[model samples]
Target: MPVTPSDIVKFIESRPGRPLSAREIAEGLRISPSQRKKFYRLLESLATEGLVAHLKGDRYSLPRKQNLVTGTISVHRDGYGFVSPREGQGPDVFVPARFLREVMHGDEVVVRVERGGRPGKPEGRLVRVEKRAHTTLVGLYEQGRKFGSVHPADPRLNQPIFVPAGQELGARGGEVVLVAIDAYPNEFRNAEGHIVQVLGDPSDPAVEILSIIHKHGLSHEFPDDVLAEADFLPEEVQPGDLEQREDLRDLPFVTIDGETAKDFDDAVCLRREEGGTSHLWVAIADVGHYVKEGSLLDQEAYLRGTSVYFPGQVIPMLPERLSNGICSLNPQVDRLTLVAEIVFDAKARRQSSRFYPAVIRSRARLTYTEVHEMVEKQLAETIERYVDLYPMLTEMLALSEGLTAMRRQRGSLDFDLPEAEIILGVRGEPENIIKAERTKAHRLIEEFMLAANEAVAFFLGQRDIPLLYRVHEPPDLAKLQAFQQFIAFFNYGLNLEAEGVDPRALQELLAQVEGKPEERTINQVLLRSMKQAFYAPDNVGHFGLAAEHYCHFTSPIRRYPDLQVHRVLRQAWRAGGLAEQERNRLADRLPEMGEHTSRTERRAMEAEREIVELKKCQFMAERVGEAFAGYITGVQPFGLFVELKEFFVEGLVHLTSLSDDFYTYEEDRHRLVGQYRRRIFQVGNEVEVLVQNVSVERREIDFTLVDLAAQQTTAQESPKGRRAQGKSKKR
Candidate 1:
C-alpha cells in the first residue's frame, strides 16, 4: 500500500520529540527518489497537520504521543518534573531530577519515553527545548564582593543565576530583583543573568503579589497607543451610534454579581409571556462596538486573552475606561449591549431565540448575596429596597428552577465543589480562607447565561459559519476505568459501556454519591478524569455542561474568545451570511486563534491558582501552633492531606505522626493501614491536626495529627516532605 498519513504519524511518534530528516524518513518508509517528492509533500502536510512538529534542518518529530511527548515542564521543588502535553491527552510524564539540569519549570520540551518506575506507566527522558517559557525570572539577590547570585522565587526553578557584581544593578542582598537571562543552563554550564529591575525590599507584604506578577510576566500597564485609544473613547453611549439598534432602556434590567465586582458586563431581565411562557433577556456589553477588530484595544485584549484576578487586584484585559467605564452596565447608565432574547415554554424548553444589538439602562445593581438573601432567605431590608423587582426576581427564581431541572434531566453534571475564597485584611494579608458556596442566585444567572451562550453557539453552528467553539471531549478510557475502580470501594460502580463512558453515566454517579462523605472525593476524581474545556475551531460537545452547542457568549470584557465571537456574529449578521471570501479567511485563522486563546486562558488560570495557593500558605504561616479540626482529603504512602474545616487550609501530616504503629499505603482504598495495630487513615475521615510548619517557598503547610486520646503536648514536630524523611519501618 502507498504510504498513508497514519503510517507516517505512527513512525514519527515512535521517536517522539526526536527529529527525523525527510530523506531518512523516505528511506525508512522505502520510498525511492522518484517517489520522494510526493513523500516530501506528505511530510510537509504532516508537519502542518497539528500532529508532527517540523524542526529546523528539515527534521520532524511527533508533537503528541505517550512515548515521545512535546509540552511544557512543571518542575516540582523535589527536583522531579512532569511534562504536560500540548495535545491535552494522557497523564503528565515523570522526569527525574537527574535529567532536569538544563530545563526549568514551564520550559517547552520534547521528552523521550522510557519504562516507568511503576508498572504499566511510562517515564520521560528530556529531549530538547523547543521554546523557553521565560527569559527573565523574579528572585532574591544575594550580593557578594566578586559576584551576586539570585535565587528564584519559584522554587521549581532551583538553579541560582550567577550575576556578576557589576550586574547586580545596585540591588542589595535582601532585595527582590528581576533578572534577565544571559545564558540558559546546559549539561556543562549553569544559567547566568543580569539584574534588569530592582524590586523593593522582600519585607513588603505587597511584594508577594508583585513577585507573582513578575514571575508570570503579567503587565499592569498598557502600551501608550493602547492607552491613548482608550482615553479617546466616548465616555457614554452616543445618539449617533444608536442607529438600527433595539432600545431596551425602558425595560427593568439589573446587574447581579459580587459586591466587590467592578465590571458589570452582563445585565438580565425577564418578562412573563402568555401561555405560561417566559421571555428572558441577557444583555452583554457590546465591547465590539467600541473596540473594533484590528484596533489597538482589540490587539491588547487578544494579547491578554483574559483578565487575571488576584485577591484584591485585577489585571484587566481592556483599559478601565472601556472595561469599567462605558462597557460596564452600571445601574442607571445607558450601555450598548448585544442582546440574547430567548423564549422558554411551560416546560422550560427553549422555544425561540434572537440576537441583536441594543441599548439598555440597568435599573439596579444587585449582588449574589443580596439576591440570595431576598429570594432564598427572605431578608426584610433587601425585599423592601427592590420591592418592585421582588416579584420579578421570585419569578426569575422559578424560571431558573425549571431550567435547572431540564438541564439535570439531560444528564448535565453539577459538581458541588467549594472554591477557596480568600478574605484580605486592610494591609493585604489573608485574614481568613473560607469555602465559597455556589448559591441559588449564582445558579440563577448561570442558567440564563448558559441558555444565551447555547443559543448563540447553535445559531452560528447551524449556519456553518467559522467561529471559535468551547469544546470538552470525552474522558480517556484508562482514566475512566480508574475512576470506576475508585468508586467501587464505596459500593458503587459506574454504568459505563465498553465503547467508552458517557456524560450521563458520570452524572448518575455524582447524583448517587451526593451528600455522602465521599462526595467531595468522588467529585474531585470525576473532574480530574474529564478533559478540560477549551476554545477550538473544532466542535466537540461540552461534556461538563452536557450541551450540544456551547460557546462563551458572556463576559466579552474579560475574555477574548467572546469578543471574537461578537465580531464574527456582527459580520455574519451584516452580510446575512458569511461571504465565501471572508469565511475562507476566517477558516485559515480560527484554528490558530483558538489555540492561542486556549493557551492564554490556561496561563491565566495557573497564575490565578498559584497566587491563591501562595496566599493560603502565608495565611497558615502565621498560625503554626493553632490546632484545627479537619478531614483527610487525600492519603498517600507518606502522609495524609487534611483540609481544616475552619480555615479551609490543607496541609500534609507525615507518616511519622502516626506514632502508634507503622503504616503502608493501599492504592485501591486511597488509605494507609498500620502494619501491627491495623489503624487506618483514609479519605473523608475526620481528624484533628495542629499546624506544625509552613513553607511559603513550597506553597505548602505541614500539620501533625492531634492524638486527642493522648495528653496534649506543647512540643510540635516539624512537617517533613514525602521523600524528605528516612524510610518507614513498614516500607
Candidate 2:
C-alpha cells in the first residue's frame, strides 16, 4: 500500500525522540519514490505546525533538539574527522578525536548531530561504526614487549593495531606486512589485530611498489578461478572457427608497439586508393571469443576494469594464457579478430566503414623503434625483416599523417608529454629512469587506432546501441577563465572568444610555448583546465581528440572497456545482431558499467603513480644534500614543488627551509611569498636546489634553498669552474 501524509505524521508521532530524514522516512514507508518531493512537503507542513522540531541542519528529530544521521567518517591525518551526511542533507559535523567511536577513514557510522555552541555548524559524536571500510591493511610491523604493533601505511586510518607475539605472522621489523583488523578495541589507543602476511622489507626494490598495490586494494595476482578458466582455453585456433571469419590472411598487416610489449592486441594494414583515397583496416583481438559473459575470466576482467602496468611488470586483467597467447596477434599466427575496415579520401575524410570478424595472419611483428627508423631513414636491415610489410607500413604512415591533419583541423589537442621509462637491473633494482621519446611510428599507430575508435563509436551510435564510449567533455568555463588568468604571467593570454573555444586553441597554446621553460607548467595547467575523459554510455564526444565520436576499440586484452566494446560489436554483427531483448537488457546495465570502469581506472592510476613515486624515492635515497636545477611545478602553504630537470622527479622546498623570508600562501595567485623580504616562489620558476632529505616513510623529498651568493659566484665562473662545483658529495 502506498504511504499517505497522515500515515507519515502518525508514524513520526508514534516514536518519541526518533529522528528521521524525510528521504529515509519515505524509503521506509514504501511511498512512490517520485513522490518524495510531496512527502518532504508534508513533513515541512507538520514542522510548521510545531508538532516536530526541525534541527538547524534541516534534520527533523522529535520535539527534542536531537537527531540521528548516518554518514561516512573521513579522518584527516591530524586525527579529527567529519561525518558527511547522506544525500548532502546536513553540513559535515566535525568530530573531535575524543568523540570518535574508534572509527577510521571511509567507515560508515551512525552519528548524533546536535547543537554545540554554533548555530549553523553542529557537532557530532559517533554512536556506532555501521561499516568498516576494509578488513585488511598494509603497514609496518614493530615488535614490543610481549606484543607487536602495526602502523598503517595509509595514514588516513586514524587507528593503530596491536597483535600478540604469537599472532605476529612472522613479520620482521621494518618490513611491510598485511594485517587483519580482528576487533575494534574499547580504547582508541590500540586496535586488536593479527598479521595476515608479511609483504617484505621496505629496502627491497619492489616491496614498496607491491605494498602500494595492497594498500590501494588492487589485486596483484590472478584469482584461482580465473587461472583455472584460462588453463582450459585452446592454444591453437580451430579451422572451423577460422572459416566463419573473413580471410585476411593474404593482407600484409603488422603489429607495432613498445619492444617490451608482449601482448599485441591491434594490427594494421593500409593502402592508397584511386583519386588520392586510402583504405585502412585495424584488426583487434577477439577476446570475447573465449571469455564468455558470466564466466570466471569475464567476472575477473570486469572487477579489475583494466590491466595494471608497473615499471617492469604487468598484472594483466586476463591470465597470460589468453592475453599473451591465443588472443595476442603474434607474428605468423592465424588469430581471430574484429576488424574495422575503413575507406577514406586522400584528405583523410572517412568515407565509409564496416565492422566484421576476420581471421588475420600478421606477416611481421615490428617494434616502435624499428618502424620509426624504417619510416624516416629506410633502415635496410629492418626493412628486410618485414619486406612484405614495407608497402603497408608506407601506406599506413601516409594515411595516418593525413588523418592526424584532419583531426587537427577539427580542433584536436595534442600535447606531447614525455613519458618516463624505468630500467630495472637483474635484482629488480632500478638502474635508470629515462624519458621515452615519441616518434612518427608511434604516432602512426596511434592515429590509426584513433580513427578505428571513432569509426566504432559512430557505427554503434548509428544503431542507437548503448555501449561504453570514451567521452571527453568540453572544459568548464570557470576553470578555463582561471587558467587564462594564470598564463598572463608568461604574457600568454588565452583567446576564449565570445563564440567560446575548443581543443585546437589549447593545442595552439601548447605549440606556442613548446621550447619555453614554462611549457611543462603551462601544459599541466591546460590539462587541468579541461575535463577528464571517462567511459560513458552517452556520446557527448571527445574534446581532446576533436572527434564527434570515440570508443576504445583496441587493446581488448588490457582494457575492460575495449573488451566490452568488442563484445557489443560481435553481438551486433553475428546472428542478425543486437536483438531487442539484448538491447533492453543492456540499457540499464551499460550506465553502471561505465561508472564502475571510470572509478576503477582512477584507482588504478592512483596505485600506479604511488608505486612510481616510491621507486623514485628509492632511486634518490642516497642522494641527499645533492643539488639540481629544477622548475617550480606547484606552490602551497607548506612548500614549493620542484621538478628536477634531469630526472623529472618532484621534491619539496619546505617553507621553513626557505630561511631568507617569511612565506605566506596566496591561493588565488598560486604562489607563496615572503612578507618581509617579498621573495616569491611561483609555478614555472627555474631554481637550483639541494636534495636535503628523502623520507622513505612519507615518500617525500625535502630540499633547502641554494645560497644566492654561491649561485651567482658559480654562474660568474666559466664552464670548467661550474664543472668543478658539480663534484659529488657523499651523504
Candidate 3:
C-alpha cells in the first residue's frame, strides 16, 4: 500500500515520546527514493492539520506529547484572543493581550497550554506562527509627515499598517485602498505594506460597499476566461439539449418570488391525483448542463461558492450570462432544468420521488405580493390579471399548507424574528428601513422547496451517493445547560436529563413563549445556544429542520452545493448508478468541497451583514436627537443594546450616559440595576431613547435615555424600591 497519513501516524505513535526526523521516518516506513518528495509534503501537511508537530532540529512528534496545541487565533476588539484547537472538543484556549503581541487575528499558531487561567477554560501563550491569514487587506489610507499608514477596516486587526513614501500608489488620505503586506507585525514593530489599489472616496455609497466586498475577500468581478466560457454558451436552450429531457411545456408552471428578484431558480406546479394524492413538480435551473466539471465556469463557481447579495446589488457566483440569462428559469421561456417529480399522499407524506432532466416553460412570473392577494386577500383585480395561474396558485397554497402541517408535526423549530429590509433610492442611498414581512405566499414557496429538498436528499442518500449534506448536529450540552438557566428567569423550562433533547421539545417551548414579552429574547437565546449548520459529506441530519435527510437541491444558480447535487444526480441517472471508481473520486473530493463552500458562505454572510449595518447607521445618522420608543434587547457590563419599535434598527446605550445613578450589571438576571434607586433595565423591557450619535465609519449608533430624571423619580416612589437614601451619582 502507498504511504498514507494514517501509516505515518501509526509509526510515530509506535515510538512514544520519541521525535523522528523525516529521513528516519522515510527509512523506517520503507519509502522509496521516488516517494521522498511526496513523503516530505505529506509530513508538512500533517503538521498543518495539527496531527503532528515540528520540533527543533527538524524532528516530528504528536502535538499532545510536547504540550502544544495548534489552532487558529481569533482576536477580540478589546485585545484578548482565543485559540480554537483544530482537533478537539474542549473549550478554546484564552490568550491575553501581552502574549498576542507578535500575531495578528486569524493566524494559525501553535500554543503552549498552561494549567492556570480563567475558571473552567484553558490559557495559552503563542509558541510560533504557522500561517498568516491575510496578505492583502482593505483599509482607509492615512498620510503622515514621514510615511503613510493604513487603518484596517476590520476592527479585529486593530493595528495600523505602515507604508513607505514611495509605495502609496498616489493614494491621498481618506481614500479607501487595498494594502499588500510586506512585513508582518512583531513585538517590536507594526506591519509594513504597500498600497496596490486605491478604491474611491469613503463617503461614496458605492465605495463603501466595495470596501466591505474587498475586506471579506469576495470576488466582485469574474475573470476573462470564465466570462468567455459563459459568453460561449447558447443564449437560448438548443434543440439538441432536449434529447432525453421530459418536456413539461404544457404544464402551468409558475414561479413565485420577490418583486425585485431577477434570477428565478425554481418553478412549481401541482396536480391533483385520484384517491386524494398530489403530484408536485419542482423544476430547478439546469446550471450543470453548461458548466461542465473542471471547466473554467465550474472552477469560478467553486471559488465564488455562493452569490453574495447586498442591498440593491449582488456579487453573483456565476457570470450574468449564465446566472441571469440561460440558466435562469425565466417566465415564458423554454428553459432546461433538473426536475424532482414527487408524489404525496393526502396527509402530505411523500410516497415516492423521481429525478430527471427536463425542459420547462414557466407560464407566468408572479410575485409573493400578487400570490398573497389572490389566495389570502381574494382580491378580484389581482386574481383576474393572472386568471390562468390563479387555479394552480391556489392548489399550491393547499399543498403547501399540508406540507407545513406535516413538518410542524415532526418538530421543526420556526423562528419569527423580523429581518430588516433596506429600501434604496436610484442613487443607491437608503431611503427607508422597515421590517421584512413573511406572508403566506412566502411560506408557500418555502414549503415546496423544503419538500423537494428532502425528497432529493432521501433519494441520493438511499443509494449511498457522495454529496454535500446540509448537516446540523445536536447542540452542545454545556450551551444547552446555560440556555436552560437563562430561560428559567422567564419561568420557561426544558428537560435536560434525557440522552438527547428532541427538537419537538424546543418547538413546544417556542410555542409556549409566543406572543409573550420575552418571546423574541428567548427565541434569540435558544438560537444562539444551537450549533451552526454546515455542509458536510457525512449525514448528521438537520436539527433545526427536524429532517432525517436534507440537502440544497434548489437555487443552483446562486449556490454551488446545489449545482453539485444536480451534477451527481444527473450522472447517476445517466449511468444507472455511479461506478466504484467515480464513487471513490467523489468521496475523496467532497470533504474539501464542503469545507470551502462552508467558509465562503460565512464570508458572504459577514459581508452582507456589515453592509446592512452600515446602511442602518447611515439611516440613523439623518435622525440625530430624534427620540424613538425601543426595547432593551441585550444588557451587558458596558451598555444596553436597544432595538427600535417603529424601525428595525438597534443601537447601544452606554452605561455612562445613564447619568442618573450608578448601575451594576447583574449577569444571572440579564439586567442592569441602579445601586441607590433600585431601578432595573432588563432584556425585553420597553424604553424611550434619543439618537445621541452615529458613526458611519465605525458602523455604530449611540443612544441616551429621553427622560432620566422623571424615570428616577418614579423608581424612587414605587413600592418595589426603598425611599431615596442619598444623592444620585452624577456622570
Candidate 4:
C-alpha cells in the first residue's frame, strides 16, 4: 500500500513529545508485521522531506521550533564549534562545548538547534556524521608501552587516534608523523589511524619549516610530468610568433621591479600626446598563448591559486622556463604580450582604450633604486652609472601619479599599512627585520596595473561575459557598529548608516594618523573591520579599489584567479560571443571555487606567518635577559604583546611580571589598568623590556619589565578620557 503525506503526518503526530523508536512507532500505528521491518525506511524519507525529526537514540519526533538546521561540524581549539549549512541561507551556526559529540573539526554532521535569539549564534549537537573533511592529520608519534597514539599537531584536531603495533610508525617519541584516519570518532571513542610518513626529530629547523608546509597542506614541488613539459619548451622566442602580434619592436619601453625579481610580467611605456593628454601602454605576459584551458598545466595552476614564497625559496605556479625566461619581459628581448593602449585626457581620465595581443621589445630593465635615484636627484651623477632612460622613467612616474590622483577623486580607499621584510644571513639564518618602504617606483607600477585590470573588467562586462572577479562586499553592520563604539573614545565615530559609509571617510581617518604613535594600532583595527576580498563569478564590485568593475587581469605567472580571468578574456575576444551556458555552469561551480581558493589563500598566508614567527623565535633564542625599547602592540587580561623597536620582534609581558599591582583588561579603551597603583599598559606606549625566555619548541617568546622608573615617569603621559561609548564603569 502506498503511503500518503497525511499518513506520514499522522505517524509522526503519534510520537508527540516522546522519543519514539522506529519499531515502537510501527507497532503503535498497527502496521502489518511484514511491513514492520520496512517502517524505518519510510521514517528516513519522512525525515528528508522535513515531515519528521530524527533525534538521538534512533528516535523520531515532530520538529518543535524554527531556525533548527542540520549542518557539518567545524570545531575550534577553544572547545566551541560552528555549523555551516549543508545547503541554504542561514548565518553560520554556533554550538557550545556541552552539546558536541565525538565529532572532530571539518566533519560533516547533522545538528539539532537549541533556542537562541541572535542569528549569528546557533547551538546544536552532532546527530550523525555524514562525511569526514580530511582523513589525514600531521602529528607526533607517542607510545604507552604496548599501545601507541598519534598526537595531532593541528590545534583544531582535538582528539588523538590509535595506532596498532604492526603498523609501527618508525618514529621515536618526539618525531613528527602524518597519520591517516582509517575510522572516524564516534560517541565515546577517538578515531583509529596509522602513521604514514615519519618526519624526523622536531628540534631541527628544517623540520619546522617542512612541518609548516605539511600542516597547511601546501605543495612544495611540481609533478614530474609538469617539469618534463616545461623542459621541452623553446628556450628563446622565434620570429614567426612575432609576426602575428602587433610589432612594438621599435618602441622604447622599460621593465621596473625589485632587484630580486626574476619573473617580469609587465613592461610600461609612456608618452605625452597633443592637447596635454597622456598615452599609456601596459604590456603584460600573454600566458594563455601556450597554456591552453583544461590542460595539465592549467589544472595545476588552478589548484595552486598563487605562488608560495618563503624566506629563501618560492614554489612557483608556472614553470621556470616560462615564468623566468620565455614569457618574462626581460630587457633587450622580444616577448609576446597582451597590451592595453589608453589615451588619458588632460584631466587624467581614461577617454579611449583598446586591448590587443602584441610582441614587445624592451630597451632596458631598471631596478627600483636606480630609477628612484634618477627621479630624486634628476640624474645628476654620470648616466653611465647604470642609470638608463632617465627621461622615459620620469614620464612614467608623472603618468602614474596623475592616474593615482584620478583614482583618489573617484573614491578609492588607499590604505597604506606597514609591511616588514625579514633579513636573512648566511645559511638562511635571521639577522634582523626591516620595514619595507614603498617608493615612487613601486607606486608607478601599481597604478598602471590597476588601470589595466579595471579596463579589462569593463571590456568583459560590456560583452556580458562570464568572469571570476575579485569581489569585496560591504562590512557586516553589527561588526561595524562594534568598531564604531571603540572609535568614539577618540572623539570620533564612523558613519553607521550603510549607504553613508565611503572609502573617502577611511582615507581621511588614515591621513589624520600619519606620524602618530597610534597609527599602526589604529590602522590594524580598521583593516580588521573591513570585509575580505574573494574570487566569484558575480560582480559585487571591490570596495577597497572603489571600482565598479574590477578583476585580476595581470600577474598570470603567480595568481590562478588571474589566469582564469585571462582565459575568459581571450575566449571572449576570439569568439566575439558570450558563453551564456558556460556562465550558468560556472556560476554553479564558482561559489565552491570561491570558498576553496579563499581557504587556500588563507592557508598560504598562515604558512607565511608561521615561517616568520619561527624565524623570530630563532632570532631571540639566545637573548634571554636582554633589554630593549618596545611599543605595546596588544593588551589582554593575561598579558600584553610588545614589539621591540630595534629588532621588530614581539613577545609577551604576562600579567604576573607586573609586580606593582593586580591589573584588569579594559577592552573598550584598549588598555590594562592596575587595581592599586593605577598604572596603565596602553597600545602605542613605549617601554623597556628584558627578554626573559625563548621557547623554540613552543614557538613563543617571553619578556619581563626592565625600567620600572621610566615606566612610572612615562605613565603620566596617558591620553585624557572621553565620554567613552564602549567603556565600562570601574568595578
Best by lDDT: 3
Task: Report the C-alpha lDDT of model 1 over 198-232, residue by residue, as the tens digit.
Answer: 88777576887888888887767899999999999
TM-scores for the candidates: 0.90, 0.83, 0.94, 0.85
Best by TM-score: 3
Q: Mind giving the per-residue lDDT tens digits that candidate 2 earns over 1-731? A: 55665687667666555577776677767768787788788787766543454555566665434466666788887888888876545567888888764777888776777556477677877666656888888888889978888899887775678898799988887789999988875653667889988989877767777788888788779878789889998998888887668999998888999989999999998888779888899999999998898898999999999988888888888899999999999999899999999999978899999999999999888899998878877999988987777877887888888988888777898876776777778878767767777899999999989989999999988888879999998886767888988888678878886545867777778779998877877888788887879999988989899888899989899899999898888888776568888888888898999989998898899888777777777777778868888889887788889988888688988887776667799876778888998988887788998888897777788876678535555664978766766763321
Each model's lDDT = 0.87, 0.82, 0.91, 0.77
Question: How well is each residue in 1-731 modelled by candidate 4, as lDDT tens digits?
Answer: 65555776687676566667877777777788887657668788766645566766888776543234555667887777988875453667778876665778877566677666376665666566655777777788888688678877766777788887867557777788888889887767778888888877776666777778887788777888877777777777777777557888788888888877888888989888888788889888888876777777777777877787777767787888888988789999888888888888887799988888898888887788777777765567734564557667777788889988888776677776766678887667788877776888888889999999999888888877877788888767776777777666555656757663777676667777767776677777777988888888889998878898998887988887777777777677677765678778766876777777777777788788778888888889868868889999877789999999988788999888786788888888878999988999987888899888997756789998786534643553444232232243542
Worst 10 residues of 3 by lDDT: 722-731
Query: How accurate locally is residue 189 in candidate 4, as Cα lDDT from 0 to 100?
Result: 77
After superposition, candidate 2 runs with Cα above 4 Å error: 1-76, 80-101, 108-131, 184-190, 377-381, 384-387, 495-501, 663-684, 708-731
Instruction: Score candidate 4 by lDDT.
Output: 0.77
By summed lDDT, the worst window of 10 consecutive residues in model 2 runs over: 48-57
Segments in model 1 whose C-alpha atoms lie over 4 Å from true places: 1-69, 84-93, 114-118, 708-731
Tens digits of per-residue lDDT for model 3, 503-568: 888998999999887888888999999888889999999999999999999989999999999999
Q: What's the lDDT for candidate 3?
A: 0.91
RMSD, model 3, all Cα superposed?
4.1
Taking all chains together, the TM-score of candidate 1 against the true structure is: 0.90
Q: In candidate 3, which residue ranges exceed 4 Å CA deviation?
A: 1-4, 7-38, 56-59, 709-731
